[model samples]
Each structure stands twice: as structure tokens, then as C-alpha cells.
Target: MDGQLPIDTRPWPVRRDAALHDQTMQQTIGVVTKRLANAKVTAYAAYPEANHWRQRAVEVKRQSIRQLEEHLATFTQQVESHGGKVHRATTAADAIQTILEVAQHHQVRSVIKTKSMVTEELELNRALENAGIAVRETDLGEYIIQLAHEKPSHILAPALHKNREQIHALFDQDALVYHTEPPASEDIVALTQYARRRLREEFLAADMGVTGGNFLVAETGTVVLITNEGNADMVTTLPRLLVSVVGVEKIVADWSGLIDVIQQPALSGVGQRLSSYTTLVSGTRGPDQWEGPDEWHVVLLDNGRTQLKDTPFEDVLSCIRCGACLNVCPVFRQVGGHAYGSVYPGPIGIVETPLLTNFEVLPELPSALCTLCHACGEACPMNIDLPGHIVQLRQMKQERHMNAIGVTRSYRWWARFWATPHGYRRSMRWARWGQWWFVRHGRIQSAPGLAGGWFKTRDMPPVASMTFHEWWDRTRGKRQ
Candidate 1:
């Protein structure tokens, strides 16, 4: 475990190319994503008025964002009134720094963590390990991936990239050290039980527990956590210091919106009406209270999120991290989440990457990455116009002078040629002539230059010898 390498943060194209060729990863991602997509469809089918509920959920988030400052102030005051501290983090570094300060203040030696994409974004686990603090992941999926030294491929199902055989192997290796004899069976429940027994010790020993906030209620200043594994509840309850480090965009005006919030993610992930656990906490355990954290900290992270408020990408903030966008995404279906080489992946990730990260470090990703199929937007329970955000980013990339001149020129020329009959016919003639050499069995399987590279991976439709109009007119003449 000491020699386990950190996650590879290579460029998207590099990771994408690798994902394209990795047969095992391809198979796992295809099966898991398909299963999730089918389940979500079936779930949505059962509820005829799902779209109506989604709209109301969108409105709740819209109203909260509109009065963000006021609500934030109210939430902050409420948290303090109940004895919890609110820390505002302006950036990823700021969030990590704040957590480190808290850890040092409490003399924390060990921390138990539940699944949190926000903390992953902050790279908090690595930071803690580097500082000689023992950090353990309590969520079963997270624990498996942590032992494997991998980042989550799916938001809800963190270990979606691994098969049962792989998980059995990982767990067997773990049990070998603890048990008198090696485990015999490859059952999922057995693996989960072993993991639970191991993590129980970590939970008791942990001085602090950190998890992500699903919905921060402005009216009550409550941090709402929804999870299936029940590890988050244990992590928050057992540890003396509990920290909810989450994105500020996760705010809603109050608890009234929770049903829609919980319902949307439930339909997408497990296709249930709601998740197994929905826990809301406003403050530490009081003298009147029984068992809870002695101290509560809610660190609200901005980190380029607040910048999206006035921008064209504002609707993206309404996302509940339901991950419905990933299941239906054509690209994600093939390459999986790791291919994006970022914490956020799939349609919404393509939109947020440039805005949240330094584009100079990453190539201005082609909007072609999205396939423009609009499946993501259709699946979104929040009614986030997801595909629209990708289009807006594509336009922004061009305006920022990030697009290559040759590619831009070629697209402009093609658009002009496509607009008129004469030009279209002339272009078709040229394309047919160019494609004649490559066409095999009525499809272009191979070509020269960029088209060759593209066709190497996918088949292209061969140009027709005659235009549709020309064929139709000839047939009409014969009929007459």
C-alpha cells in the first residue's frame, strides 16, 4: 500500500486514448453504465409526472441562487447560533488549508472520510497522508478504490470500474492479514462484511470525520447528507470533530426542496424513491442531545463555482451531482469517468473543466466531446440545460481565440457549401471523388490525413454518386 501510486492526472486526450484501447475497462464501463441507464429509464417510466417534480426542484435552486447572499448570511448565523463554525473557502487550496488548520488545532492523528467528490477535488486525502495523519475511507466503494489507489469512476458507485472478481481479490488480500485463514468465497455480502469489520476500528479511532454536503439548507443552516452505505452517518456521529466540506452551489432555501432533491438522484442511481439514508445536522451534540459530533464545521467552497453565477453556465450550479448525465452519455459509456482526467466528467464535466480549471494547462476540449446528442439534458432531473452549457463553452473557446485556425476555416467553408444547392452539389462531387479510393463495401473504413485517423476508429458514410434531389427528379420523370 505504501508503494501504491497516486491517481494519474494525465491530459484528457492521453487518458481517452488509453481508455479507448483498454478492453477490460471498456467492458466494465459499458455493462455498468448500461445497467444504470436502463434502471433510470424504468424508474422514470413508473413516475409519469417526474418532469413536473424536476421543474419545481429547478425552481428551488433558482430562488436560492437568486438570493444567495442573503441565504448564505442567514445560514451562517444559524450554524453559529447552534455552535457550529462556518468557514468560507474561496478556492480549492483555501479549502484544503482550512481543513489542515482545523486538523492541527484539534491535534487530529487519524481521520475517517466518507465518499466526497469535493474532498477529492481538494486532494485532501493525499494532503493528510503527506502530513503523517492516518486517513481511512469508510464508504465501501471508496474503501475498495482507496486500497486500489484509484479515483472514483462513478459518483454514486465509486468502484464501478471494478468487477466482482477484482473486488473479491482486493478484499481477499485485505482479509488475509486480519483473519486466521484467507477468505474462501467471492460473495459481495461477504466482502462488504469484511470491509465493515475492518473499518469499524478506524471509525472508533478517528479524531475527525469529513464528508460532502448534499444540500445545505439556508432556512435552517442544516447540512443534508444522503447516502446508501450508512458510512457517512457513522463517520459524522462517531468522530469528535465532523466536517462537511462541500461546494457552495449545493444550497437550497430550505428542507421543503429535499423531496425533489432526494427523488432525482434516487431515480438515477438506484431507481428508488429515495436513498437509504437522509441525515440533516445543524450543530454539534448539545447538553440536551445524546450521541453526535462534539464539534461541527461546514466549509463552503467557492473554487470557481461562484464565478459561474452571473455567467452563461449558471444553470450548471443547479446540479445535485445526481450523475444522471454520465449514464446516458455516449462518450462516458465508452471511455468511463477516468478518461476525462478530472474529478467532474461526462457532459457537465466538459462544460465545467475550462471554467473551474486553468484552460492553459488543459487543451480547449472540442464540443465534439459531447456528441451534441442532448441525452444528458434529457436525463437531468434538475432540468439543467446541460447540452446548452457545452454549446456555450464551445462558443466561448472560439471567442477566446482557442480554436485552431485550420479547423475553424474548414468548418466555415463546409457551412457555406452546405447552405446552397449549387455549392452542395459541387462539394458532393469533390467528396465522392476524394472518398472513391477509400470506400469499401459502401462505407469509408479508411482514408488519408485526419479523416484517416478518425475512420480508423469509426466507419464514415460514403458520399452518394447522385444527390437526393437528382434521384427524386429522375424517379418522378419515370413515373410521369
Candidate 2:
């Protein structure tokens, strides 16, 4: 992908409205998420020990985050011992600056990158471009979105919001720019072939490579990348200078720790046993080595992650970015990732964006984005208590008086009303009578006020003429 715009800066409601109204995005996201969610179930079933692995993965991540500093120190020592340099970036600006300095030191003109969410977080491509370095995203989906000047709508599938027809249009424009032919048809094979041809040229010509690490093994100073495409391999091998930007939380104690959680992102995300490619970089190439970068650097980024340690939000750092929660989130299914208006999307994003930024940005994401279904908790391979975190965040917001007065009052009254049998019975009676205006045939077709939004796409059965409590009192009182 080439020069893309900054992340959407629109207000949450406006961004959400756009996603809801875009029929193409809705359909595309719905189909893909549903398919992936179902596939995750089937894949888990096929492996009898899936539950055990998930539990073990959770343990490894929990322990890793708990002892993060110790692991990070070991990882740094090992990487340096192997000739790879380590840069500890305390903020987004620091990370970007470090990478730019490395690129300038090597006189990198053009850079190629594999898919990296961390890079997206730093808006690394834009920063590199600002410094007059040409940056290209090598992942097919990322390249497509790069051409379209958009951010990823889904974590695993960057272009999940796009359909085949829409992709053909983007590719056709690229083909014209390159003075080459477009795909013969809107087929997957033809589209990928065109991309492969274009990216192959960049792979050979680029002076530097950039990647996001999935896991870093402290025992050996290794950076692990799991991908379906071989672009990461090219990025690491062909370029003289290769830089990996990873969250400090990504480091594990050792290879045994890496083994415990490596398959999780693939299995929980897209139901694959493993991605098509897994590349590990221990260091820069040795004199005897025929392939690999001459200069290797790993920028371990904190950027508020360290602030989460020892806090209730620590479980959030365990997220492997698998995106399984998004596939099953009802709210995410309807609104899509762009609506969340962050680099990350879905359940994890809801907790992460607010936490990473310390709720200074998008303070409403926790309360607004979740349905509290707990499906995200079940779907997470790391067993991150996403729903629990969201609830706590919402509580934090409420304590800070971030919610609207009217909404707060409404929920307060509703909770009070439902706390006792008498109030509940009285409210049910009021609802039965008050719902008459909206009721037609056998259900409440529409509602007034905030309730209206729910009824817009869903109908509710009218409150029954007699509550179970009332019926039991009338019938069983005589028998008693």
C-alpha cells in the first residue's frame, strides 16, 4: 500500500452512521465474520486438545505480562549478542523517530513492509513518507487498502470491507498507472497474480524492510512472524536493513513459552492450523550467510502498555490480535471496524484503544461498542476477560461522569425499578399498557425515545396480560 490518509478523525456517532448505512460494507463484514466464526468452531472441534492449548496459552501470556520486564531484558541481551540492535521506545513518537533514524543511517530510499498493526498504530508509513522515503505495504490485502487510501476494517483481513468488484476497480486503476493490463476477470487468482508481479519488483529494489513481531522469544532473541503470504520472508531477506516494531508485551520468557501460544492467532482467528508461512529472525546475516538482512533492529514499544501492568487491565495485554472476538460480536457485525474509528477494531479494540490512550481518546468506546454478550471472552484464545474489562472501563467512565445526565438517570431508574418485585411488577404493568400504541398484530413493532433504535431492526413480543408471578399468586394461593 502507498500513501494513505490519517486514521478517520470523525466523531464516533458520525463514523458509526457511515458504517451502518454502507450496505456493501455491512454485507461483506457479515458474511466474512460469520464464516470465520463458524470455521473457528469446526477447527476447535477437530482438535481434541484445543481447550487445553487455550488454557496453556492463557497461562503463558498471563505469566509473560506479569514478568514482562525480566523477559524484555533477556530478549534485548540475546538480540544484541546475536548482532541485532534493540531500541526501547516509550511513546509512539519515540518509535517512529527510532525507525526513521535507522532508515536514514542505512540511506534507505524505498521501503517494503509486511502487515503490521503496530506500524499502523505509529502510522509508520506516513511518517516514512513525510521523510521522503517511499513506503509500500506488501501484504495483498494491505496493498489493496493502501491503494484505496483506507485503514483496515478487520485485523486479520485488512480489506474485509471490500468486495471483489470494488477490488477490481482499485486494481484496474493501479494497472493503468503501471502501464500494465488489469486482471482478466474479478477472480482471486488473477487479482493476486497482478499484485505478486508488482510487489516482486519492489522486493528486489527496496533498501529497507519493516515488520511487526507476533512473538519474541527471550531465550534465543528471536522475532516470529506468522502470515499466509511469503511477503514477510522477502521483506526480511532482500533488504539490507530490516526493522521490526513490536509491543513490549509481545516478548515471552523463552521458546517453550512461544510454543505454548504460537498457534493461537491462527487457530482462533481464521481456524487455520498454522498460517502458510512462519518466519523467524534471530539477527542480521552472518558473513557466511547467503541470505538475510545485514542490519536488524527490533524496536520494543511501550506506548502506555507498561502502565497497564499490575492493573486490572493487565489481561488486555495478553491479546494476540487473533480477531476471533470480532467475528462473534453482534455490535461489530453490524457496524464494522471503521465505525470503531481506531487502528484496532472489535472487542479487543474496544478495551485496547481506551486503555492504551488512557481514555483520553474515545472515552465512549467501552460503553458504546459492547453488547456484554461474553462471547468475546469465550472466543479469545488467551481467555482475556474482555467483557469484564469493558464493564470496569464503563464503571470508570461513570465515576468520572463521562456519561450523559439523561442516559445515566434513565439507567439508574431502570436498575432501581428492577431491583425489587413490587417495582418490577408495577413497571411491567406500565409497559404492557404503554406499549399498546406501538403494538400491532402480536408484537411491539416500534417504540418511542431511546427504545426506538432497538425496534428499528427488531420487534419484541408485548408484555403478557398476566405476569408469571401474578398467575402463580392467583392459582397457587388457593392450593396452598
Candidate 3:
């Protein structure tokens, strides 16, 4: 939101290069993801009931999506009954337009926001700024990136890439506006205090506030904003007019459904048993509440999600945005979020983006990026079957003639060899003799010619002289 930081609107190639070159991004993502992944493993070990909870969560989300229309109607009526306005948007453009109209109608000039992936997906900050309104991000992580003019490298920790020194420098650059020089100390507490002080003023001064909802409880028409830092609370409570932008798929059938699916993953994803602040706002605050917002608006953005319902990919909707999958993904751990060339990243992005955009632009992600470990699928509370979706995407690419030349040829060879057991055995026999040149101490050190590149970083095992089936047959005959 700061005007000083450089804007990065370049195409995917340029953006990817920038992200890759960011050493800070690399180190931050590595440390954070590793730590969180380990913590989750420990937490699950402590709670042997996690598998049971996961199943219940998946069922709740499935049922919610099945009865989505009914739930949405009920939600709308509940919100309206409590003096809140609900606006439905069919696309990103429509959602942006609706928000702009609401801001203009309220005569709002400056806005404060909490971290919301949905808002990031819509690029609402850019849209509002272009309309000549100033916006400030209240969440600490979001505020740091807002200053840097960079996209989030991770969902839970948006500015996870920044260290103390870098953050100190960023604060120094913007300190003049707060009427104080940046503190000399690089301690965590000092930096946090400085950011809190600066953001608190913006919270009080802003005419409008915007946040993303974690879950929309259809039974009560309540919007839940879960946070550890309490920034979301300020964003929703202080401003006169508060608007919440939520993806339509975030809806749950009832409060009970939310209890079953939404809270645990959100908590575990961040290494916390529960967030410090869990505020539920059903409608505009009444006069009896001494300090609270007066007007409320909930903008439900469909943004291509309706088409995904009832399909295999509909399970993606069950994601609570806890970011568990991002922490465990090997590809995401290495390249970070920006490499995905989308607001959403990791296994979820690879599957969701193509489906949401209808594959208009081919994503640069490779099928090889996935080791087919199914780790992400296990981590997902919704049991989205992420590996299954990735395989489906690969099939789609093959059908469209977009698969790489080498991959297509490899698959063709595999199909031929698999069609006949005799042919496969004959090929294996030839391969064993052909591999002798590369064999050293029972391992293939490197292959000759084109195949050498595959062994550059790995040692391939030498092929056995006899096939498994042949050995088994000979052993059985001798025993008889």
C-alpha cells in the first residue's frame, strides 16, 4: 500500500526470476516450513485422534458443498435479519466493482485491511489504490510486504522471508511518517512495537476496513476472523464501514460444521492450539457496544468456484486456508510461493489455478515436481487427494497435446513394454547387459550419453541379472 516500494506487475517469467533471486525468501521459507512441518508431526503424535477428526472434517465439508445453495440462502437471510448487507459476485471483476462502489458510497478515502488470501487473489489493494484511495495493511506480516511491494511468499507467514535486519531497514525507510526515527535495536520486541504503534494510528484514522473471512457460518450468518495478533479485530471493529470479502467455497452448513472442520486445521497449521483472538461478528454493532463498527457488508466472491462443485476437485473447497499443505510440499519448500506465478501457491495452487482459470494460461509447474508421495493429501484436513488432482492435470495436458516431448515418448515406451510380459522381460535382460559400463561397486555411477544427466545427482542401482518373476519361477520349480 505504500507508494515508495516498487510495484511488480511483470509477466510470470520476470516474477519467477525475481522470486528465485530473493535469498531471503529462500531462507525464510525453508526455516518456517521445516519448523511447522515438524511441529505438526509432533502434534498429531500427541493426538492419536487426529485421523478421526480429519475424517469428520472431510465429511462436513462434502455435505456443505452438496447443499451449498440452501446454506447460502440461509446465510443471506440471517445476515439481513441482523442488519448486515450481503452482495453476491460471480467473478473477480464483479467483486472488485462491488467493493469499490461500497467504498465510494461511504465516502471513504483511507482503508485498513487484515491479511486475506481472497483479497490478495482479487488484487484489491491495487484496485483501491488505482481509484485514488490510500490503503494500509494492519496484519504485521502483510504490512511488511505492503512496505516491500512484494507478494506473500507463504500463506500463513506472508513476510516470512524478512529477518530482523531487513525489517529494521524497512521500518527506517517509513519511520518519518510516524514522527519518530526507526529504533536502533534489531530485537523482535522492538520491531513489533514499532509496527504496532504505526498500524494502530492507521486503524483509528481509516474511514473503512476490509478483511477476509476464514469461515462463514451459514446457520447463524456469522463471519469468523481468526488471528493471533488481534489485527483483524481492530480492522473489523474500529472503522465505521467494514467489508469482508470471502470466497463462496468458504461457507459451512452450520456452526457445528465449523466446529468439526474449520478450527483444528487452522490452529495446527500455525503451531498453535488456538489463536489468541477468535471474533465472530454477525451484524453491525449496536449503540450498547461502546466501540464497534456501524455498517457491515459481506461480499461473497464465486470467482469460478461454482463450476467446481460436485466434481473430484470440489474437495479443494474444504481447505480452511490453514496452509498445512504448503509447509510439507517439497516443491513449495524449494521454490517458495511466488514461483507458482499465482496468488495461491503449493500443491493447492497447482491444482486450483488451472481449474479456476479453465487452463487459459499454461502453468509452468512440472509433473516431476511432485514425487507422488501423497504427503500433502495426508496433511489436508479435507482429504482433498492433491496427488490425484495433479495426475488429472497431467492427463488434461496430455489430451491438449501440451505435454513435453520427452514425457510423451517415455509414456509411449512404458505402454508398449507393459502390454506384454515376455517383451518386458526381454528388454530387462538387454538392459542388464547394457548397464555394465556404468556399474561401479554394485551401483551405476553414471550412464553413457543422454541418460548420464539423470545420474548426475543420484546413484542408480545396477539392474539384476534375472527378472523377479523368472527368479520366483525357478525357485518354485526346484522346491517342487
Candidate 4:
């Protein structure tokens, strides 16, 4: 939405700790994620055989990722079979160059885009601007972030961190929508209408329409774009050329998989049975057809995805980006997406970022984040097993950091020591003695060293003089 990456670029702990204390972010993220969590609950309860549908999605996704190349080839051949051109991009630069070339061929001046996270990954908007072409974000949340010069904080709800008053302020600052009435002062109806009226001009004048594919059905060579606001339809309706930049992983063999693709994401994301618009593009509009683009193009992006198929992270390729994981993630609920410092955020982002992008610099990303809650897996409509994938990444990271032989030995020593009954009791007794200095009124009011910061906002109960096992044995003996 910001037309730029909002990565903090600091150490992970520094960024996370900063976001933790940010009262505004805490309030905003907490309320929004919790509401989405509740909505997901209500939505799932209403659906029949929801778990069955989820399992079906997982099966479909696994099948697709395993034969990703075949499906992608079928998708491309079918698109070309239908008179649409397809470009295969191995990197972000390739995608941008492909899009630019398409723009050149079409003599594109202005472009109106729907919410496309892959496009954001390519920084397509900024690249277009650099090429002296104008780009407008048609999605409402995306538009706000574009105006604010900030990246999307959430995958589905880009402006999740901002409230209505904040949104009104953002609109107020935009010179494009200003008039005598000042745009209805926090009225959702007025704000939407104001945006709709203005965006219509952008849509009408756009030479090209760009979108991200939710699912590409290979059998018929169709690109599916879903949106709740009908903005994608508006963008596609009148442009001279339509281009979809899609990840190779988004392709499915046929229509049988498309229904679950549509329904599961909607149920997990906005809790809707279906999104308001599910636009399917096969080819350029014919004279017999009502109205559509004159040209159609599909850009299939690799961007390190090929490497994932054989790796332990292959399951990650199956993600549908429904963002249900984000809604239920305790870590995401607190810090939000910006703290993760990636285009992809939440549980999925941490797992994928290293695999897709620079693992050298972002080596600690997964271990730095994730509480290993498994809530993400429960929420994932595709059942991607996010925690399992995270553990793999952690193992990979630990191997690299295993150069610290002393730290490894000490950690292993402690882990083994604590595993024995005698060591456990001795350690517990010593820990109780050690904490006696910090205990007050049945709680450890403070802790020493690095632990002190943790207790700054938290309290732990003091350890009892006797172990639970000892107490249980004595109580049982008395009962007997």
C-alpha cells in the first residue's frame, strides 16, 4: 500500500521490543486481530463440514505444489492457447522488466491496480513511477497506505493498524479529494463515495489493469482475482490491457480445486461465504463481448520458489495467503506485521522470508519470531502446518549457529541435566533458593540480569519449599 517496503532494518529483538511498548499499535492490533479471530470462529461454526473442506484444501495444495511445474506449464499453455501471452520470471527484477515491457508494448501511461501482494514484492508501483508512468492503487486499504507512504501491515486488511479517525485524517490530507464539504467527517458512506468518484477517473484513464491471481485454473487458462470491494472488477472493466502478476504456486490443474480456493480464503479472511467479486480473465475482449481489455498477459514469478519444492519448506508453497494465521497469532496480535520487517508477515512470512529472500542476513528471522503455538496451523484453511515448518527453519538456523560450540554445549548440558529426576529436584531447590532474594508477597517482584526486563511487565509466583511430587505423596499417605 505504501508503494515502498516499510522494513525497519534493525535487529529483530530491537524492532519487536519497540513495537511491544507502542501503546497505539498495541491497542489497534489487539482489537483488530481479536475481532478477526472471533469472526473466523463464527464463520467456521456456520459452515458444514468445515474441517473436511480444510483437509480438501490441504490435499489440493499439496498436489499442486508437488507438481507445480506441470501445473504452471499447463496454465501457461492454456493461457497462450486462449490468445494470452505468458512471461516466466525467475526473479523480482524479471517480473518488473516483464511488466515494463508489457507497458511499453501497450503504450501504457497510467495503471490502476487491485491488491496484489506479489506486485508489492516486485515494487511494481515505484518501478512504474520511475519509468514516468503513473500507478494508482484501487483497493481502499491499499490506497490509504499509498497515500501514507507505508507498506501494508496486514495481507488481507492492509490498513488494519489504522482506525476510522486516522483514515479520515489520511483522506483529509490528500489534496485529490478536497472540496467545500471536507468529505463527510468520518462517515464511512461519504468517504467511500468520495473515493469511488475519484477512483473512477483513474480506472477510465488507465491504459493497463494489473492484478494478482488468487488461483489460475490450468485447464481453461483462467486467472482469478478476488476482492470484496469490487475494485478489481473496476480496474479490469475498461483498461486497454490487463496483466496479472502471479506466483507460480497459485496455479491449480482445473476447476474442481477452484471452489475450495475461493470459499476457504473467504471463510478464513473476511468471514464471507464469498468475496463480492471473483473476476475471471481468459483472453482479450472480443467485439462480441460486452467490454474488457484488448490484451491479456500473465507473468509467472519464480523468485526462489523453485528451491522450496525439494526442501522441507515445500509445504509453505501451498499457502493461500488467507491471513487466518495472522488473526489467531498471539505474536502478530501484539506486534503486527510491520515489526516482522518483510512484505510477507506473521507466521507465514517468517518461514518464507528466509526461503524466498536473502537467508544470509535474515537467518535468525524464524527463531526470532514465532511462539511455536500451532494456532497458525489450526487457523490455516489449507492446513499448511506452519509450526512444523517453523521448527525446520529453527533447526536449519541452529545448525548454522552451532559454530558457537560453548553455547551449544552449555545449552545441551542444561537440557540433559534437567531431564534427570535428581538433577531436576536439585536444580529446582537451587532455583528456589536463588529466587528467594527476589520474592515478595508470593510473587517474584523482579528478576536479575537479562530476566529483569521480562519481569518489568510480568510477575511469576514464588516456588514452594516442597515439590508437587513430595506434596502429592504426603497427601496420598494421609488419605490412605
List TM-scores for all candidates, in order: 0.91, 0.92, 0.88, 0.90
Clashing pairs in 2: 1-137
Candidate 2 wrongly placed segments (more than 4 Å): 1-7, 417-480
lDDT of 4 by residue, 355-401 (tens): 78646445566777788989998888876778998888778767767
Off by over 4 Å in 1: 1-8, 176-184, 358-361, 364-368, 432-450, 457-463, 469-480
lDDT of 3 by residue, 171-224 (tens): 988897566858657898989988988887898899999999988899899998
Worst 10 residues of 2 by lDDT: 1-10
Which prediction has the highest TM-score against the true structure? Answer: 2
Error of 4 at 349 (Å): 1.3
Better of 1 and 2 by lDDT: 2
Model 2 lDDT, full chain set = 0.90
Candidate order by TM-score, decreasing, is 2, 1, 4, 3
The 10 consecutive residues of candidate 4 with the worst lDDT sum are 1-10
Task: Enumerate clash totals for all models, in the order shown.
Answer: 0, 1, 0, 0
lDDT of 2 by residue, 227-248 (tens): 9998899999999999999988
* Residue pairs with clashing backbones, model 3: none
- Kindly provide the TM-score of model 1 when superposed on the true structure, using C-alpha atoms: 0.91
Q: What is the C-alpha lDDT of each candidate?
A: 0.81, 0.90, 0.81, 0.82
